[model samples]
Target: MPTEGVTGANKGIGYEIVKALCQRYNGHVYLTARNAIKGNAAACKLRKLGLYPIFHQLDIGDEESIKKFRDYITKHEGGIDLLFNNAGVSFNECTQAYAKEAENVINVNYFGTLHAVEILGPILRYGARIINTSSFFGHLSNIPSSSLRNRLAARSLTVDGLCHLMNEYLSDVRNGVHVTKGWGDSPYTVSKVGVAALTIVLQRMFDNDPEKRQISVNSVHPGYTQTDLTGNMGTYTAEEGARSALFAGLDAEGLRGQFVWDNLAIIDWYAATPPKSF
Candidate 1:
């Protein structure tokens, strides 16, 4: 039987994704969150709606938590048919120092998501699907430095190289020279850009895996959703925001290494105009 999972699904767009999967997917859907109480509550709510979704505790920021979840899936489901890298954090106000804010945001949003994939990718079933919930702001055009942009867009850029770039950004932030170094002002934006880049990198790796030929990996901009992440200031509801991600996760076959817009159309990540709603 096919099995799928979503991370950070206790609430908001992630929760909506899990709910949609339970209603439409023809297999087990796991709703995961760092907080067990909230994750179970979300699962119960789905049960009330006549949809059954299993709950799992997952903290993408913690490697131990990730390994535990991977082990459970390996033991119980054998392998995952679909995985959504959705757990993330953002700061509405820059109350904290730039360096501190950048570190915390990058830890959970980029490195954390990348680590989760590293541990789980090997167990993905043949023809599996992977979707990373990136933002339109994550487009390569967000980086103003021409050299940095070109390096990121290079076809030969490897995962290690990406990690090095992210690390360099953090180092620059720590030295209070990120802006001078041509890094973006918003750490959240940079982290999501890393997520989008990682999506393509993973897709390339999957292409080399003979056992996982048909697996498609893509990043999606879930529109501007009125979720806690946005401080409820967005134009769309959580349910509406989840539509593009849900479409990509459950459908969008053969669409690997691409950036999908809120309308579910594939866009050129480097050249497309930024979505105005975000």
Candidate 2:
């Protein structure tokens, strides 16, 4: 049987994604969260609804926690058929200094997600599907630096090069010159841009692996969903936001290495301009 799993699924779009997977995916669905209490609670809620979802504690920010989960999945399920890198954080209205916020945001949203993929990716079954939950805010247009944009859009970009760029951003933030160095003001936006770039990089790596070429990897913008991440200010509900991700996870074929929008349409992240209102 196929096995699917979602990270950071204790609440919001992550929770809704797990719920939908339990309903539609013909396999065991693992609902993971950093908090065991909340994870189990969410699993119980699903059980009450006549759906079976196994709960696992996963804190993407910690490599040890990720390894434990990876070992468990490897041992119990043998391998994962579908995986979602959904755990992330943002400080939209924070009063903290930009430098501090940047560190925290990038740590969880970019590095944390990257760590999860690095460990679990090896255990992904052939023809598996992987979805990286990115955002429209991550569009390349958000970064005003022409040179940086060119570097990021380059097809030759490597995973190591991408990591170097993210670390450089953090360094600039530490030196209090990120803005002058052409980095964006929103750390959340920049970190997500890293996520989007990582998606393409991962796809390239998969393409090089003869056995893994069938695994489709794509990044997606889950729309402006009303969830804790948005402080409930977004237009779409969490359930509504999960549709695009669900579509990509279950049915997207020949759609590899693309950035999909909430409408389920693929957009050129490098050339496409954000809506005027965005």
State TM-scores per candidate: 0.96, 0.97
The lDDT per prediction is: 0.88, 0.89
Per-residue C-alpha lDDT of model 1 across residues 1-278, encoded as one tens digit per residue: 89998999999999999999988889999999999999999999999999999999999999999999999999999999999989999954557676888888899999999999889988988888888999977888888777888888889989999999999999998988888777768888889989998888888987887877688888999988899888897888999999888888877766888988998888888773565544
Report the number of backbone clashes for model 2: 0
lDDT of 2 by residue, 36-139 (tens): 99999999999999999999999999999999999999999999999999999987555657777888899999999889889998899988888999998878
Model 1 spans > 4 angstroms off: 275-278
For candidate 1, which ten residues in a row score worst on lDDT? 269-278
Q: Assess candidate 1 and give its lDDT.
A: 0.88
